[model samples]
Target: MNHFIEKTLQLKDPNITIDTEKVDEVKVNGRFSLIYYGKLSYTPKACECCGIINNAFQVVKNGYRTDSRITLNTISAMPAYLKLKKQRFSCRECG
Candidate 1:
């Protein structure tokens, strides 16, 4: 949904760029779904001794529980399915 993508961009910092083409549509219960795939520019800081940034990694998917009753409502009332994609990195500077 355009609205969903717009909302997502609004929530992020202005410096971040979202890749809209990476978004995918999945069929859930015979209904269309929207998925987003993209990466933002991130700066990696190193410790005082070693100044090398760590390697990049792929993102992971996260899921959440939904209210069955609300989800069973009319398709119009049902909200879009959202899967949050995020990555985890370890920094020796902070560790």
Candidate 2:
């Protein structure tokens, strides 16, 4: 499943991951595009302020923001709308 998603999405690295189980469908709203809802995250996040790397320790999911971006992939002769849950991380040590 992971391999298929990596290939389909053209993900180059293992650190960059996506949760495909969160969404059930490739929503076809009209003739313009398809919407794919998913969560996006990067492993071994680093603190923006302190430059501290957190693989697990002192790391927390502060919040997530809904983000939309244009991808090179096309679906049904239309562009793909990747609705991503962009994760925000914080470090307890930095705070």
Candidate 3:
């Protein structure tokens, strides 16, 4: 699992630093979910013209499952990115 996380981080951003401290595991619906918390130097929601900044967003909840019945079964890793918008701010400049 650690290796998978490492590979994911590398694929996401090779230059930015990843906060392992914020990384955590949770059990939901009897399935294991991995959570990652970190800040990207480049903001995805930043306004191109005004350069106004937007509040940080949380990534999506990701999960994976495997079946042991099949011989040499290759279960592809599941990838998901969840973004929750903040309601506190309604910035016209960045909206």
Candidate 4:
């Protein structure tokens, strides 16, 4: 999965991580569109509310946003657009 994304997006170790629980859809015609339902690979090591840096600060999954961006490369010999529904997170202590 990682290899495919790296090759397709031409990115090395991109911070975006796919959510395997959801199925990714790809549309290919004259142009290519990859609808990846995933999340940003972010782990908060500190709490913004109390300025605490420890595991006690609970990180909660907030929601998600559909981010559509143009890719630099083409897929299947066509221009590719990435539609990523990235999951959001928040600190329980702050919110």
Candidate 5:
């Protein structure tokens, strides 16, 4: 569950959701590692580019960027990582 991961990782962001669909277990440098995927998405209250309120149209979802690789404290002596998919927002009024 998303809450389980958030609690475990001590994440305070409500917009972040842990994607447990397919957890990756890979070998790196001859050692095994675990990778967790997380997605960050939220509607913007205001446009950062023009400072205009969303109002259902001013700002819109602009898809997500590639997952970023972030190192985490090793779990049980094995390396751990997080692949975060950050959402993008575009301001229609500014564009």
Candidate 6:
């Protein structure tokens, strides 16, 4: 299921996992769009902002960026989108 969507949409990010059974039709800026739900998560080896190594008491899961809409190439002439809940990390050393 995940593999099918990835191949069809050309999404190569390993962190992204699509909910293949779920899809929605919605309006974006007055135009109809097709949206697919998914989640993005990964364990980081280092903090992206401060470059501090990730470990105990270092970079950790802050929460997530939810309902982020990313545009994709049109599917069957309709605008396609990915609604992703992306994992986020916070650097204890920097913040």
User: What's the CA RMSD for each of the models?
Assistant: 9.4, 3.6, 11.4, 4.2, 1.5, 1.9
Per-residue lDDT of model 5, residues 37-91, tens digit only: 8989998899887799888787888899998988887877889888899999888
Tens digits of per-residue lDDT for model 2, 3-83: 786687676756545666753334455455655556666644677788787755777777777575646487457666666
* Over 4 Å off, model 5: none
Rank the candidate models, highest TM-score first.
5, 6, 2, 4, 1, 3
Q: TM-score for every candidate vs. truth? A: 0.35, 0.62, 0.33, 0.56, 0.87, 0.82
Over 1-95, each residue of candidate 4 has an lDDT whose tens digit, in order, gives 75676565665546766544554445556434544444465566776676666486487667776675535465556555555656566776666
Q: Which stretches of candidate 6 lie above 4 Å from their native place? A: none
List the candidates ranked by lDDT, beginning with the highest.
Answer: 6, 5, 2, 4, 1, 3
* Candidate 1 per-residue lDDT over residues 1-95, each given as its tens digit: 64466464453444334455565566777867554444334443443345455444222222323312112122334334334433334444443
| Poorest lDDT segment (10 consecutive residues) of candidate 6 | 53-62
* lDDT score, candidate 4, position 76: 58
Residues 1-92, candidate 6, lDDT per residue (tens digit)? 77988999899999899998999998988999999999999889998888887767598777888688898999999999999998988888
lDDT of each: 0.42, 0.65, 0.39, 0.58, 0.84, 0.89
TM-score of model number 1 = 0.35
C-alpha lDDT of residue 60 in model 5: 85
Question: Of the pair 2 and 3, which is ahead by lDDT?
Answer: 2
CA deviation > 4 Å runs, candidate 3: 1-5, 8-12, 28-30, 43-47, 50-95
lDDT of 6: 0.89
| Model 2 error, position 33 (Å) | 1.0
Best by TM-score: 5
- Candidate 4 global lDDT: 0.58
